[model samples]
Target: MKNIKIKYATTFTIVVLMFANVSAQNKSELLLQSKISGVIKKMALEEKIAMLHGNALFSSGGVKRLNIPELTSDDGPLGVREEIKRFDWNSANWTTDSATFLPNGSAIAATWNPEMANKYGVVLGQEANARKKIVMLSPAFNICRMPLCGRTYEYYSEDPFLNAQLAVQSVKGIQSQHVAACIKHFAANNQEIDRGEINALIDQRALREIYLPAFKAAVQKGSAYTIMSAYNKVNGYWCSENDFLLNQVLKKEWGFKGIVMSDWGGTHHTAEAANNGLDIEMGSSGPYDQWYFAKPLLEAVKAGKVSEKMIDDKVRRILWVMYHTSMSTGHPAGSIATEAHGKAAYDIASESIVLLKNEGNLLPLKTDKIKSIAVIGDNAIRTFASGGYGAGVKARYEVTALAGIKARFGKTADIRFAQGYKANYKASNSDEQNAGYDKPDRVLIADAVALAKTADVAILCIGSNREYESEGHDRKSLELPFGEQALVNAVTAVNTNTIIVIMAGAPYDLNEIKKSCHAIVWSWFNGSEAGNALADMLAGDINPSGRLPFTFPATLHDSPAFALNTYPGKERTTEYKEGILVGYRWYDTKKIDPLYCFGYGLSYTRFTYSGISTDRKTYKTGDKIDVMFKVKNDGKIQGKETVQLYVSKVKSSVSRPEKELKAFKKVLIAPTKTATIRISINVNDLAYFSEKQNKWIVEPGDYKILAASSSKDIRQVAEIKVMR
Candidate 1:
């Protein structure tokens, strides 16, 4: 056995030296270049085809003779998914696989800080690298089209520019760690209803402006190494085999040199998929051998139906990913969930907690004044590590909100707890299951009210669970699931000094709760240190700095999709008829008042904005306009403020949004001190996608640059002229 091990190691060293010699000879080593071609030409036809499909549940095969190692693709965006067995979905049951869960996508986006996004990506990438994963299947960039979209928590925001900016930074950070960041769910995969079969019909302009910008940024700016095609169809073709989407738009136009892999069981046809830009087919219907890229592809190539060149190209891209990531980079593998990562998770959650309403200054609660406090709700004491039937990390430890609260105030104050409602973890499988899941129970409500009556102040934690907001299905409505509103009403009736903390993944109806509660905070499904972060904010240890990444519409009818009859479309086909008008664009254009505007958040301290000016009053194409603004922390507390800059065309021939976010900056200021922030906008930022011309058009006109705290609250405006 020892002699055999020595011989195998010796062989591996020789192959490694050969690859290094080829790479050194061709210093450029571009994708599909001489170094990759040399290896491909030597590969047998069967071996090349084998590299194009899953050899294991979450991995693909590699040619051992060529020294190419199997690529271990792990689910991420938050953290690495727990290890699973090679042939099945069963856990590998490894003792050291517990990872640190970072903040969810929306929660990180809420920070409105690109630097923090980069840090989040770095931690995730480091953990993935330590786990020996070459590709971290994450940084999902799907636009949040509807609040009820079950997978909204996994996405960034409705605004394309904001999403694009953050995605670029995240991709950069991940790649910096030598792990390929796979930006996923390409095209208009905005909803989860019938995800595998739904045909998304979107206009070309909307596709460019609203849905595809982030992917574009990931490719052009971030230089992402891999992309995962959405399960749904963009127009009529399945995303995995959509010729125009994958070949024309993604590959040719955007210059995406990365490999395109199908989502699990997302591929349908063999010839169409190979002919299109799909480089790999993950899993398909039935058995592993029946995958579209396996036997079918082999038969096609042998019969001259599909050329051997197509199989070679696929193998080339696969080899490219391996060469670029840790497989060839020699990043060592080990455990990496350190105390610093935990602090980073807690910091991100603290910055993401949005203070929606703080009427009469009820927040930043003084713990000394309150002798007894009631923490009533399901989420307050529950652990939120993983959810739904999708990718999730098995965290080493999770801090519940109740636990964090006790750790913070348990010594000084009497902390009381009661289960207000039972939050169901299991998602509904049928209509009967959904009905029973949503049914209300009077006993839980009575117990909560009794606890609230005795306490001086009640912190009502209420919102949807994994069942109501997760992958595999779309939510029916924005209402809180499981009779949470009834519980809130009953508790608030007993104690008027109640604070509401929404522990949901997305926005929900807050009209009734907003009226009764003294304070309201939107805390997303934060990561492993969620409770500790929430406790810090409540105890005045850290001031909240998060902003709403997407607009919270007043009602479902007010949404662009619902008003335009587009979402949850009939007959498996959904229309993005709302076009460029999504989220805040819809509300601003329709003159509708949303419950909260985009980029809206309240800090413990007050900020005063002034001295908004631009370096140039008129600018031509390619010119950069530097907008300078002064943000002063007027209140007594130290806090961070995000300065937003929006641009609007004065009078354009084509219809346009009222204003779109162009640039932003987050700055920390001392009490009574002012910070001068300078944000520059490129001339190309003024360009709008012109469908008639099939290109971006920078119309020569006067434009207004508005500096603001939120979308609606414009503080200062400067007029600028764009010359041809």
Candidate 2:
């Protein structure tokens, strides 16, 4: 009787789950039918309006009668943010909330590998699911418009094509786990200086081509289910209430089917933001009732200022997202910071470490070649897991560069440590910007130089701290802060064979030590395994294959945005006077040289590009062109190569960049082996945003297709005629 009862219970449980699955599918279909409409009709006016604003700091109201759960969201584009208090921004102090700190957004972009980005999303999605979050506010698609933008570490690349491709992959990975990926800071949230009030006065063409492409792709290709409105204003209106951006471009033109949620404290008006297309308002200060979309929205609906249909539409979209993700369907519970997630993070960091300069093969330091290795700088021992009131994750563990090197060669090599310079860039109560070590620390610099003089090779680990690069404020300049420049120069003077490992997100002026330093490596603020990954590359356990996602201008003024006075506008509004010329495009077009070009990285092993071929000499619209090239790993080691395909119009009526990246492929080849890479690009990719027609138009003309390793390193060129 007991055995029979257990058997029956097991059978009953399976049947119930099966029924639930079927019900979920039917409910999803019903959402598209009159059932959702009927459910909305039954909801009271106040309840309907309540669903549009946050009931807590990270969640919105749900209709209990309809069995819709509150929309649970988590902060961040990199990893799941640390758990917060129920009704406030304070930490919840939950041990389970600790996550696998993957490489920062800039580090991921440096990898130039979309497959890794997909894996990045998968792990992030799993973590979010583990935390019971229906939506992961991630896969931030904001372009790297300026190096000084405080949140540069959170964004991807300068180029729209590269940013779009990686963003799409990340979105696909997140949504695959039945979690909504919220592409954030929608539409020209570029700078952090007066972010809430600054108006980005951009023209339609520049907006379509540069600032908006990644978000567009996140919706169309990634199938992202949610978007977050930026805090800043676009043109003349806030992003939360800008109909031209939210309605005209995002929804109607690009066919974005997601719900648009306002950033924390981002919504200002109830009726205007609601009617414009904001589906949810999140994170207003004080009590929930004080939110812009709370009592004000309820009053608006009661007074007939905002339509009932608008409320219904908002609720419908929110339900649609929940139905697709956590609400209707059941997801397998996942664990945070699993071993697999750790490996993925390590792999991404390993690939993303860029070897900017390795003169005399100074890197891959043969463990046996050196006796005493001097590791100097405060960054060598710092953990970059969380910082600066931005999106951050509390990692279970973080590997600092010093720890990693010691773990790798501690047994065979004697590693000497020196503080070098104190990194005091942490924001303060009195003065957030200039509080830290902005000037040279002579005492610390003297100690570091003395230590360097006694070592075989001095490794100077220096770069920006969290305060200098975090969200909420723009950097004062692109210069290295906290006495890093003086420290590096002093240390290098003592030891000419100094190796510089810069831990920074955006580009910095390397002109100080570029000529004197024997080698330089850019190790972005990679997550938990950051130190271990750096050790692997320095010890030659893995080859360096990362590339710069943005150009390192010789000076800040070399950047078109700064050079043309387009950034940090006057009278609360800034014009994109430089237009579409950004990053490498500006450098290439104006003949202004950059310290390091975009897509520039050096590997331990060398690779050669040859056998460039095109599918056909001529093509028309709606056609595909296959650009084939063979990459040979000429060195005596296995390596990967990023084949970048760029296209330029031979002659055009409208102003355009010298060349734009259309397609790219990352491939690995064994030693002395050649791999043929075929990158297919649609003829439509040649289209430029036309102001006259207010649409993307492909002009009939001859185009030059170039293959290159970096923007400045063109390996091959071919001409193709477009007869439209």
| Cα lDDT, model 1, residue 488 | 84
> In model 2, what is the error at residue 206, expressed in angstroms?
0.5
Query: In model 2, which runs have C-alpha deviations exceeding 4 angstroms?
Result: 1-35, 428-436
Question: What shift in Å separates residue 516 of candidate 2 from its native position after superposition?
Answer: 1.3
Q: What TM-score fits each model?
A: 0.95, 0.95
Give the number of colliding residue pairs in candidate 1.
0
Candidate 1: where are CA atoms >4 Å away? 1-27, 30-32, 284-286
Local lDDT at 217 for model 1: 91
RMSD of each candidate relative to the true structure:
6.5, 6.8
> Per-residue lDDT for 603 in model 2?
89
True-vs-predicted CA distance for residue 148, candidate 1, Å: 1.0
Best by lDDT: 2
